[model samples]
Structures are given as structure tokens and as C-alpha cells.
Target chain A: MSERAAAGIRIERVVKIFGDVGITALNEVSLDIAPGEFVSILGPSGCGKSTLLRCVAGLDTPSKGQIVVGGVPVSAPPEHLGIVFQRDALLEWRSVIDNLLLPIEFRGGDSRAVRPHAKALLRMVGLEGFEDRYPSQLSGGMRQRVAICRALVDDPMLLLMDEPFGALDALTRDQLNIELQRLWLANRKTVLFVTHSITEAIFLADRVVVFSPRPGSIADVIHVDLPRPRKLAVRTSELFHGYAGRIRTLFEGMGLLKEDE
Target chain B: MNRQSLQGVAITTMTLIVFGLIWEAGVSYFGVKPIVLPPPSAILRELFSELPWYLGHAWFTLIVTLGGFALAVVIGVALAVLIVESKLLEKTIYTVIVGLNSVPKVAIAPLFVIWMGTGAEPKLAIAFLIAVFAIVIDTVLGLKSVPADILDLGRALRGSRSMMLWRIRFPCALPSLFAGMKVAISLALVGAIVGEFVSSQRGLGYVILSAQGTFDTARVFAAVFLLAILGMLLFAAIVRIERWALPWHASQKDYSPSA
Candidate 1:
């Protein structure tokens, strides 16, 4: 972990319940992420990993618990944090460049100043020639790239991704994972990613936090001592397998891992 | 213009001419009196001969149609926004609007004339009543139909309520609003003509009523033709505006059948 002073995210006893039913989505979940660290909250479907991310992003308030980001309590989404959703969620009417500039527009930033930065971010995300194209004209992977650029346009201190590449094909997802790692390295923004892929979590995260299903709670938090600038080749490495195996064991212990696979 | 569009225009003009010729031939062959069923050519001649007199009537009808259409758009959009913003109001007011919309607007035109007045006001009111409910229902559905993930994205971006409305909700609702506008435009035309038929000194509706009373079939045909043209023009205008405003919409793109 980087020796950054501030805590990126601090969650304490977070509990979320839908309606009057005491059936919990999240039960006494707590986690702490260091500044500039890339952490993945890994779990199967209905594990409330997404709910945890939403609570941290302040999109949904926890029924009971506290979440602090960058030394400030996150009751509502703050200007300094950026979020990338599973679907691109890009405005179909807007051009790729305009979509990238959306966060800046929301924050009341100088449009003229942000335009250049937005352009640069789009280029960085490998969408250089697609600036003027509308979202409908772009392929699914390209649209997601535009969304990533939009999230990073404001140069936010923290980035929250809820399965940002979950909908993409395996090839596209792998490519984006590499792109994302490069982005995280260059920006050094604190990132909390939610995903179901064990290999993905092992490949991308400094720490992989696993959760149990239903009334989801942290099953385990395993540190990945894998070296930086991870490439696709790293996936076949023994180190990658070791980390993936540990995560699988954790899921197996929670009765989440399928016996067949 | 493309070859297909040019060909389409040629075919449309040819079809109209053929229809007109057939009608003229049928009337003349049957030796139909001008008082009963005059030829299409006779109606055309009468239309051109009394152009200035009909222009005034056309203007009056246009005013009522346009005025009512404007009112419907404003009230419909505003009410849709209100309904979408509040569930209790939506449930209560939506039922009332639906009930009112179901009642034949023509039956209420005379009542409107009594309440408002015969001069343009009642006509406009009738048109407004006819068109507004469609706008409200379609626009409300459009506003509400925005994807939940998009809304969540807005929330995540910390967008203000006003920002969300102006930037996201309004634009998202535009296609649906245009759909409502198209339906309302047709209804507005019918409403204006009906209002004039119920009580009016001028307009195509008045002309048709007078022609029927005097047994002048050619004049009645002319008036009906003009009204059809007016309805087509108004509907076409709305479609053109929709194309101009929402060029990014998927439906606007000319996709190959194979693609």
C-alpha cells in the first residue's frame, strides 16, 4: 500500500435492510481501504457487494452504519468521488466527448477548462477518434470506455466501480482490466471495485475482500502481494493461481463455491 | 434528394391524380347534379374562385387549432411533471383526466361555448381538452420511463435535483413528448373543426355546414379537401420538428435491413 496519510474509505458496522422485513441485505459489514489502494469486493450474485459499494458511494444510504471517504462522512455523494456503473449509463443524446465532460458539468466546473482534460481522458481510454460520435453509434465496449473517461474527467480522489466490465465479453473485459490498472497507476486514485470474477479480483486488487450471500458480510479479506503493472500474462502466473485459490477456499467455506466447478 | 424519395413523391402525385380522375369520371358518367355530388374538378374550380374568402376562414380555424395545441402542450407537460413528481397526485388526478378524456369532446363543445364563448375561445378550449390528456399520459410515461441505472448514475454524480430534471429527465422525456405532440396535433385539428361545426360564423367547418344547407356539394367537397390538407400539414410539421430536434434518436437513423 502507498504511504498516503488519509483513509480512502472507512466503513463501520454497515447494515442495510429493505422495507419492514428484517431480512438484511448487508449485516454488520465493515471495511477500511487505504488511500491510493485498489481494492476489490468479490462475491457471487446477491452477496450485497453492490449494496456495499452503493452505500460507500452514497447512492443509497445504509439503514444503519457509517461510511467515511477521504476523512469526510459520506452521507451523500461528494464531488471528490467518481463512480462507474456496470452499464455505461451514458446519455444516448450526448457525444462521447460531451459524456466525458458530464461530471464537470454537474460540479459546475469551467467547461472550457475541463474540455481539454476530457479530451485527454478519452484518448487515454483509447477512444481518441470517437470524440464526436454519439453513444448509440459506439459499440458496447467503446461506450463503457467513454463512461470510464467520464468518471475520471473530474480527477476525483476516489473511484467506485460496480462491475464496470461485468456486461462486456471476456476479451473486452480483460482488455479493460489492463486499461484500468494503467489508469489507477497513473492517477493513484483510491478505487473500490465490485466484481464476481475471482481471477479479476486477484489480477487487479491489492486486497480482495470476499462476502457471503443474502445478509452479506465480509467472509475474508486476503492481501495479494502481486507486483505492480500487472499484465494479461500475470493471469497464468503461479502467484495469480495462489491468490485465486485462497479466494475460492474462502467462498467454499461460506458454501458459496459450487462443488461441480 | 434520394432517388427513392423522388420516386415516392412521383407515385404519391400520380395516385392523387388517378383518384381525382376516377371520382370526376364517376360523377360525370352518372350525370350527378352539382347539388348532390359534383365532380372533383368542380370542387377545385370553386376552391380557387373563392380563395380569398376561404383564406379568412382557414386563418380562423388555424388560430383555434394552433392556440389549443399550444395550451395542450404547456398544460400537458406541466401536469405530467407534477404527476411523475408525486404518487398521490398521480393516482387521483390521472383517473380524473382519463375519465374526462373518455367523454366525447364534441358533446362538451356546446357546454364550453356556454362557459367560455363562441368566438375562438370555446373552440380553443375544446381543442385543448381533446389534446391535453394524451400529452399528459405520454409525457408522464416518458418522464417515468428513464432507466433506473441512469437515475442511479445521476445520484452517484451528485447532480442537483434541478440538474437531473433539466439535463437528464427532460431530454429523456423528449421522444415521448414528441409522440404526444403528434397525437395531439391530429386531435387539435379535429377539435377545432368540431368546435366550428357546433357554433361558428367562419372556418372550413362553417363553410361545409353552409354548403350542406344550400345543397352546394362542390363547395362542401372543397371545404373537406382544405381541412384534410390542413390536418396533413400540421401532422407533417410536428414530424419534421421531431426529426430536427431528436436526430440522435435510434428511429431517425436509416439502417439497412441486413444490418
Candidate 2:
């Protein structure tokens, strides 16, 4: 999607099972994400989208197959990859800036050098006046923004987001999606976001990968050739509806759609 | 002071004065001797006149209480960590600790005196025994109470085991640790007094015993009053330390209980 020659993530037939029960969480899932591209893995609940994301981030070791990031096999979480979880997961004890400083501290990076960058990233995410507030003082959406700033603070090469906006209300989620697109346009980091919302996957992703239900495998990969710098109005366009319909059809074929029909 | 606090203070002062007046009047009107049920005024005079002697005894009791409490905190927290870190150890030792806690610690005081002798050692041992179990149990619960999602975040961040403990587990467990300390502090005081009751030469318990032996009711009342004051002071100090340590706690935020 980015016209880059190098691949950011290359998952080759990854499989994961929990314990001796041999209950597969993910099976033979393989895909590649190009450098500086935005990809979304879309699926219903219990479809192992999260499990696959965790494997890519090296949070979970695949029982079989390999995951490579930036041409290196991922045995552990690399310092250059940033992950934002569904929950804000902000340290209650730390101030907003300190929360952003955590990963840098863990990586033994220079916080002094990164402090300005951290502030800039916060401003980009629309959190300029909230540097002193604790996570508890902020609303849910504001906290998620802090979490995003924290993820990007270390200047990571890839951003792996696990339903980062799933917990927010519709309006907040929509606002954040626009902000995310602007930030992505400027920063141009490779992103792999997991989400249950088809509209979100269609709107934000350069390409969307759909997964089948439990013991999941890749069902399809849909390329979104829609124009860049997407806005709220773009979500109401015919192209956006067509993309959503295609993802909906994939879910329907897999017997995963029940509630949103 | 606010009206409610002022009312509380007034009520407390009035209750104390009324109790003292009634005791004095009852002793005098009922023709009670100084040897039995002495008037509150006599006890107050005795308390002030022998303040130096009582202070020394108070210091001895305080030392034993604090020492035992420190020992309990160390041992309990270490044991809790060990158990929580290993499932096998938890399964084997948790039941044993519960069983030990069920036995009345006061009944074990004489055994401690027999094993450690009639000095501060036995008192310290008794106090440690009384305080340790609560700390261990509460701390274990606290450590385990850390949400799975928080631990997952640490894991996702690739935090090392020690990093996880220092950054996530320990801070999260602090409120429970303080709760355990509060309960243990009171028990530590009780244990020290109980130990002194069994076989001590220089504590409030010793003074009370000697006064009772000679039927000096006023001195007995004076010694009891000192012990109560000591307990209240120790409890208050722990509360102050808790406030200083956990300024972010909900209980510490704008909390001003009347009186």
C-alpha cells in the first residue's frame, strides 16, 4: 500500500494452541504488511483476531510458524514496535507525561531527548493541556489519547493497536479515527489495528484482513483503494458502503454475523 | 472547628467529666477505702506524681511492640512473596498458616516464655506471632488481586519479572499492606502487654501486677491509663505514616471525620 519495497510484518503460517487440550486459538494465519501501510484485521468476537495480533507483537509465542518484523524473526517484543491495548492501561500512580515516559525508560532510551518528541506527539493527538493530569482525572477518550501518545513516544517503527478505540462511545471513536488518520498521514508508521467494527476497518485501513471464527484462519484480505485523508463524511460515501458490504459478506459466509444484521 | 466536630469534642469532654465525677462521688459516698475503688482524683494525682517511673515502663513496652511489629512485617511479606511466586509452596504452606492463625496467640505466650525465658525476648516473640499471620494473609490477597489485564499489559510491554513486581504488583498491593499493618499494630500492642502479664520485670503490665498485689487501686488505674494512652499514640502514628505514604488513596482525599 505504501509502494515500499521492504515488508514491515511477515507472518508465515503461524499457529497457536492453549495447553494440552489442543484447543487452537489461531491456525495457519499468514499475512504480510508493507512498510508505512495501515492494515486492519477485522473479525467478530471469538474469531482469534486478538490472538493473531498478540503473536505478531511477540506477546504470545506461536506454536508453529514464524513472525518476522522488519526482516527479523520476532521471538520477543522488539523495542521499535509500540502496542496500544483496548483499555487505556495507564499507570494510576504516574502523571500523564510519566505514563508516556514508561516504555522509553524500559528500553533504556534517553527520556530527556524524547521528552520534546513526546510533547509533540501529545499535541498531535490533541492532548496539549493534559500533561499534568493523572489518568483517573481524564475521560475515557482522553485517557485513550494519552495511551496512544505513550505508544508513539519511543518513535516506534510499527504501531500494533488491539481495538484501542473499542471501549469508547461512537462519537468519541469517530473523532479519534479522524485524528488517527491525520497522525498516520504525518508519521507514516506501519500500523496493524484489530477491530470488531466493519465501518472502522473500512474507513481507516489501507487493507482489511478478515478472519474466520474460533481456531481462526485468514478468510480474506480486502484492499481499500479509497482516497487518503479520510473524513467523517467519507464514511457516508458509496465507496465506504461497498467496502463495508464486502466485509459483511465475508462475516456472513463464515456464519459469524448475528447481532448487527 | 466545624459545628459537628465542636459538638463531638464537647460530647467527649462531657462524657469523661461525668464518668470521673460519678466515680469520685460513688467512692466517697459509699465509704470505699483507698485500697479498693479509689476515687478518680486520687488516681490522677498518683499518675502525675509517678510520671517518670510510668514513662520508663511505657518506653520498654513501646520498644517490644515496635520490634515485634517490624519482625512480623518482614517475615510475613517474605513468606507471602514466596508463596505467591510458587504454586507448590502456596498449596502446602497456605493451609499451615491458616491453621496456625486459628490457634489463640495468647495461649502460646506461656510456651514462648518457657522457650525464650522471662525477658523482652518472649514478649517480642509473642507479639510477632500475633501480628505476622494477618500481614501474610492480607498481603497475599493484595498481590493476587492485581487485575489480569494489568499483568497482561506488563507482559505485552516485555517487562522483566522484577520490573513487573516493582512497577505493577508492589504498588498495587500497598493499600492492602497498610490495612494489614493497621490490624497488626493493634495486635502487636496487645501481644506485648499479654507477654508482660506472663513474665516481665519492667513494663506497664508489671506495674499493674505489682499494684494489684499490694491492693493499690489508684496506682493500678494510673498504670491502665498510661497503657491506653500508649496504644492510642501508636495507632495514631501508624495512621499518620499511612497518610504520608499514600497521598493518592481515596480515604486520604478531603477526608475530615468529625473529631
Candidate 3:
């Protein structure tokens, strides 16, 4: 591990307008994420939570605002950061171990030196025996695990994930949630996870930043005081339901979730 | 080979033998004139007697086809990359290639003979011109087919444009490139024969043409048989290369998606 301090993020009034017709995806969205915080941006589909994540990753630039990461403004994908998409994005030609080593290779590090770290990460994800397996050989859940290992192989300070479990089955999603929490507890890297799952956001995040529907802006921020090393059973607790109920009510206000007559 | 592939080979060989027997019986039963359509037995006899002579002409055709195919791969891949990388090249170069492909390559075979003379050069040139189009089109398709999320992942990782192309796009394009090559190799053989037809002193095409002029129907059948074998071998060679280079794709083919 790098032993470097985790990075904080500051999204200062970021406004993103797409194309000539001026579709405003993010409308003056701003948030402050402390170092080592696990923050999830939760909202409905077409909500600019993903847009916010993209701005922080430097994959897209905000038209009217700036994003500061690790004490410096993000220009072109700031150093010591990693991202995972909904799809595993593992190079089909590469084996699982090689896929894990991709970020190191991209950063001009010697892959030979990082091989041990990559192996350790795979072991951490319960994929030790699958080091030589191709992505196509693995199930959907296993591929996503490889992708998460790939992102963490470089020991990034800030990790951004965009709906990383959206495609997974419910059982796999629950399992990955537990694994992700364990991993997060171990490294505690600053994570800005984007998702539409209310329970998932509250279960995984230190704070859930809810966004309104399209032309997305922060609707509310709910802090989860649930203890560390949270198990799946914790999701059924009264306190967990309190946080979920608050988020549900917020979504109901935004016309995202409705109570049937 | 595995048991499955061995069984496949056995079945293919059995089918070919049945086809040969049918042709032999039909020719003899119909009492076809030797000058019109010789029996498969007669063609086979000619092939065995002139084995060394037929081998030399077949070798010439093979060399010209392979040479042209190699040239097409190099230039075609380079051009496809340029077309993908630059909007200007896509607009100008790709448009020109598509336009040039529409003109019949056989119609222009004689032009290559006129320009490069009655040597291997014209045959190779014709083969290249005929084969290049498939390479460019399939490669372009493959390069563009990379998933959007994968590109976004590359961008998030700060991959340089050249690095992304080399590490991601090019490898992703391999299966499609192999598909193009398989088609091109067969087309290259056809182009080589056309070039030889235009003007050549050697190759299977020359042997066929001279035999046709002399009314040596058996010799023509033998040369055509050799050409068919050559084309099949070249195509099989490409399929083998595809399997070797794309182990992931081959293994994935056997994978049941329900898993």
C-alpha cells in the first residue's frame, strides 16, 4: 500500500450543459467530501449523480465550475485516482491478473513489480485461484470483482465508481456490498459511488448525497452513523430503516418513488 | 487434434470421396467425350502423372497470393488506423477507398499487366487491390466496436491516445481483422488467377488457360482441382491463425451464455 493520505474532493457549483441545444444535466451541483469518506450520490435515472462523478474523475469537464481533488484542481484525470464502471471493462484479451495490473501499466509503473500486489488484491476479493482465468470464463459477479481489484491495484487515494453493481443479480449485489465494505474498511480510500439504490447508498456510504431528478442538484445529505464492519444483517435494523425511510421520503418528495393508491 | 476435430476431418474427407465418386460415375454413365468433360479418374490420373509439374505452377500462384495478402494486411491495417484516428483521413482516404472498391477489380487486372508487365508484379498487384477492401472495412468495424464504457474506463485511467489504441482498441479489433483476412486470402487467390489470365507465363492460371486452348480438358480439370485445393488450404491457414491468436474468442465460442 502507498500509505499516502486519502484525498478530499470539493465540487464547487459545477454546471454542465450538453451540446448545442443546452441540455443542463447538472445544475449548479456542489458538495464537499472529506478525506477517507465513503460518500454515495443516490438519485433516479438521468439524475446528474453520474455527471458529478464524471466531473470528479476528469472524464468530463464542468462548463461553469471547478473540482478540486487532493488539494489541487482536477485538469486531466488527476494522479493517484481510480474508477470502476458498471461493466467490468476487463480487457477480454488479458487474464484476470493482467487486468488487475492495467492501471499500474497505464501509470507507467513496472507491471512486474506490481504483480504481487495484484495477486494480493485478487485474494482479498476471493478470486485467488482465478488469476489466469479470462474475463469471459468468469461469471458477471467475478468479473466485477476483478474490475474492483484492478482499480485498487494501484492503491489509489480517491476511488470513483459509477453504478458498479447495477447490472448484478440481487444476491450478487448483496454479496459485493459486504465485500466492498470489508475492502473499504481495510483501505478507507475516499470513495464517491454513484447509484440509484436507496438501501445500497445508505448501506455502503458514510453519508448519502441524494439528488433531485434531471437537471440534478443536491436534495439532501443523510449521515449514517452505523458502526464499522457492518454486516448484511445491519440493513434490517431499526436505525438502518430510519435512514432508508428518510431517503425514501426525500425520493417521494422528488416524485421518484410513489405510494400506490 | 481433439476427438471432435478428428471426427470433423473424417466427415469432410468422406464427403469429398463421395463427391469424387459421384462425378466419376456421372461422367462415365453419360458417355461424355474426353474433349468435353473427362471423368474424375482421368483428371486424377493426370494429376498424379504431372505431380511435380503441377506443383511448380501451384507454388507460383500460392506465392503471388500470399505476397499480395501480406501487402494488403500491412497497408490496410495502417490505413484503417489512420481513418479511425483522424476525421480528415476518414473523410478523404476512406471515401476514396470505398469509391475505388466499387470499380470491378477484374476489369482493371489487364491494366496491372500493362503497367507492371507479364511478371509476378502484376499478379501480386491485382491480388492486393482485390483483397485490401475487406481488410479495411472489417478492421474499421472492429476498431469502432469497442464498448463505450471501456473507452470511458481508459479515459478515467488517463490512458494516452496511442496507449489506448495499442492496448485496448487494437486487441479488441483482432477477431474482426481475422475475419477480414479469411475473406481477403480467398479473394487474393481469385485476383492472382485473374492477373495470370490477363498475362502470365506461369502459375495454375497459365496452366489452365494453355490447356483450354489446346483442348486438353483433363489438364484443365487437374489445374482447377489444384486451384480449389490451394484456396481451401489458404483459408484453413487463416482459420488456424485466428484460433491461435484469439484463444479468448475460441474458448468463448464454446461457452454457454446461460452460465
Candidate 4:
């Protein structure tokens, strides 16, 4: 477990252009994420927020600038990095527990050694006894929970989530947001979460980084002074509403939401 | 099997019996000569009396079909992987396979006989050639059908190429591979019989040809009946293996008694 230390990320003036059309997906985006801080990137659809997360995960290489993780330059996927996608992406053929052990198998680690940790992660997410259920048999929210367990199984230092709970219903989304905040409080790993929901962003992050519409760069970063182990009731609080209102006003200023409409 | 499947079997058996009786009554009413078309009873008699002789020929054909199918699976899967993993093979080798597949396999059966003689080798080769196409095409589709997100997940884990192929792509392809095997197995049987028809001293195909020469309709009917039974059994065997191998697949649920 000594190798399970959290790693900070440095994204320095990253620029990404796609295809021959010169369509700029990300333009000179830069941010520094402290170790163990939970940062949510909030933006609208096609705002390149997901692309920024992909760059940090090393699934896409920026056309310009660089990303460094834990004092090492990113050329390929960095060590102990885990990622979760919006679709859950669980292998249907493998059972829940086996899906959790996939990263271990890919990394050439002993699966038998990681079985206990896998079960513990499942238990943490309220999926205590579904170890043998296939992904097809699970509900959407449950499948996403298993996906989260799979990401954490190898104890990745840096976790990147791209709209991980965006597909769920409103109630399930709130439940997952609370569970995710609890998990972060326990582990304190550096997490870079990308989402479009304003309430979800501030509820689960120490700082929410807002991005402008495409050719996306950071528009604003708002620090949340909310206390740890925050309950659902916190969302109704004055401070929480204040943060959401601020983000809405910013979007309105950018013409993303027209006041007349 | 459960009660429903057993009932299904019973219904199928009853239908076959009724169909056989209709054929028998029609032949007697028409006063058809045995040389034209023997009644079902005569064919049954011929089958029972010469059962050992039929078994010997049937065994040879079965062996040839199985050998060809096994070879097709091994080589076809390997070829598909190569084509998928390399753009060069996809452009060159895959195009050639598609072009050749368009040519009717029966047209080339005689070529195999001339090359490999009347032994089992020629029959095996023809069967493999006919069956390998389905295996390659379907396997290629399966290998390429893995979801992009799954591929990205594999990449994020820093998995090697072989690891991705083995752990992710291969298992994901199993259902499609089984579908190909079902088609290939039947094609292999057709290839085997075609090979025997072109040139052969043994097997059911030889029995049918010799019976036709002597105008022994009963013997010809016996061999034909055996061939039909063999094809069904082989298809059923493939289906059984598919069910066992892919319990995870959605198709299995449709036929499941509980579902």
C-alpha cells in the first residue's frame, strides 16, 4: 500500500486540435490540481471539458504544451492512473468482482492479492453482495457503481472521471454524488471530474473549474468552503445556492443561457 | 431439458411421423414402382439390414467434416487477428479472401480431387476451404466490434497489445465466433459431400452414386436419410457447445426455460 500515494497534476498551456479541419477542441487550457484535491470541470456539451480530461488521462495528446503528473512528464498513460467514463464501460462478460480486478490483471499484478480490496470497494459503494452478477443483470446506477469500484481496485493515485454519473436519473445522481464525496473524504486522492451539472460540480468538489463553450479554456474557478461529509441538505443551504447562482450568471454572460429565452 | 422443451421435441417427432405416413400412403395409392421411389418402409428395412455398412461410410464422412471444421477455426481466427492487427493484411489478404469467396465452392471441388487424389485429404481440404470463409469474415467483424470506450479503458490501464487482444477483444468476440462456427459446420458438411461426389471410393456420397447406377432406390433413400440426420446432429452439437460457451450472451436468455 506504500505505492498508493496521491499525485498532483500540472496542465501547462495545453492546446488540442482535431483532424485536418483545424477544429480546435481545446485552446491553451492550463490549470494546476493540488494532490488530493477534488476538482470538477463544469461546462456545456461540446465545450471540450471531456477532451481536457482525456488529455490528462493520456488517451489524447495535446497538439501543444505539456502535462506533468507527480513530477513526471506525461508521454504515455502515467502509472497508477484510473479512469471512469459516462457509459460505465463494464465488460458484460465478466462478473462484478472480476470487472473490478481487470486493472490488476492488465498491470500483471496478482489478482488473488487484490480480491479483498475489490470486495471492500464494492461494499463501500453499497454493492455488498453483487460480486457474481453480470453487468447486463445490473441496473444502470449499479453498473456505474461497479465501474467506480473497478477504477479504485488498483488504488490509482490519480482518478479521472468524465461525466461518470451524467446518464443517471436525478435522484440516483444525487445519491452517487454523496457517495463519491464520502469516498473522496476517506481516500483523499487527486480527482479530476468532468461534468455539466452545476449543483453536482460544487457539491462534490473543493473547487469547480468552469469552461467556456468550444475552443474551451478555463473561464473561472470557484472554491467551495463547504464542510466535509456534506449531506444532501447542504444543497438547500444559502452558500450552496450562492455558488450555483454564480455559475448560472457566468453562463448567462457567455450567451450559453439567454435571459430573454 | 424442461417440460416446455420436451413438449417441443414431442411435437416435432409427431409431425415427422405424420409426414412419413403420408409419403407411405401416397406411394402405395399411386402404385409407384420401387425403382422410381421406394416407400419409407423399404428404405427403413434397407437401413436396418445394412446398418453396419452404412455406419462405416458415415464414420469416414464425419471424420472428414470434423477435421476440416477444426482446421478452419484455428486458421481462420489467426488470419482474422492478423488482418485486424495490420492494415497491410486487411488490404491484401482480406481482399483476396473476399474475392475468392465469391466464386462458387462446388466449381473448384474437382480441382481438389485432382490435386490430392481420392484419399480423405482432398475431402478435408475442400471442406476447410468452403468453411474457412465464414469463420474469417465473422471473426473479423467480432474482433473489430469491441466498444471504443472499452478500448480506451484498456489503453488507460497501459495494457500491452497482446493483453488487450487476449483479455478484452477475444472474450468480446466469442458470441460472434460461435455464430460463424454454426454456419461453417454446415458448410463443411456440404464441402465433404461435394468432395466425395467428385471422386471417392467410400463414404455416403459413394453409396448414393453406386445405388443410383444399379437403380436400387431403397439404398439411395437410406443414404439420403442418413445424410439428413447427420447434418441435423452436427448442427445441434454446435448449438449445444455455443450455449455452454456463451451463457453470458443475450441470445441464450431467449431460449432459457426460466426466461
Best model per DockQ: 3
lDDT of 2 by residue, A1-261 (tens): 222232388999998998799889899988989988899999888888998888888888999999999988989876577789899888866779989998887776788888888888889878887787766667889888888888777777888899999999999999999988987887788999999999999899999998888788898999998888887898889988888888888877877666674
lDDT per model, in order?
0.87, 0.86, 0.92, 0.92
Q: Candidate 4's residue-wise lDDT over B48-117, tens digit each?
A: 9989999999999999999999999999999999999999999999999999999999999999888888
Q: Which ten contiguous residues of candidate 2 chain B have the minimum total lDDT?
A: B250-259
DockQ of each candidate relative to the true complex: 0.51, 0.27, 0.62, 0.49
- Which residues of candidate 1, in runs, are more than 4 Å off? A1-7, A259-261, B25-36, B254-259
Question: For candidate 3, what is the TM-score?
Answer: 0.98
Q: Relative to the unseen true structure, what is the C-alpha lDDT of residue A208 in candidate 2, on a scale of 0 to 100? A: 93
| Model 4: per-residue Cα lDDT over A1-261, one tens digit each | 325889999999999999799989899999999999999999999999999899898899999999999989888889899899999999978989999999999999999998988898888889988898777777888989899888888988999999999999999898899888877777888999999999999999999999998789889999999998899999999999999999999999888998754
Question: If you assessed candidate 4 against the hidden native complex, which CAPRI class would it receive?
Answer: medium
* TM value for model 2: 0.87
Taking chain B only, the TM-score of every model is 0.94, 0.89, 0.97, 0.95
TM-score of each: 0.93, 0.87, 0.98, 0.96
lDDT of 3 by residue, A53-111 (tens): 98899989999999999999987888888789998888999989989888888889999
lDDT of 1 by residue, B1-259 (tens): 6899799889988999999999899988989887878888888999999999988898889888999999999999999888887889889998788888888888878998788777889899988989998899999889988998889888888888888988899899999999999999989988999998988898889998988898888888888888888998899899889989997788876642110
Q: Which stretches of candidate 3 lie over 4 Å from their true place?
A: B250-259
Steric clash pairs (candidate 4): none
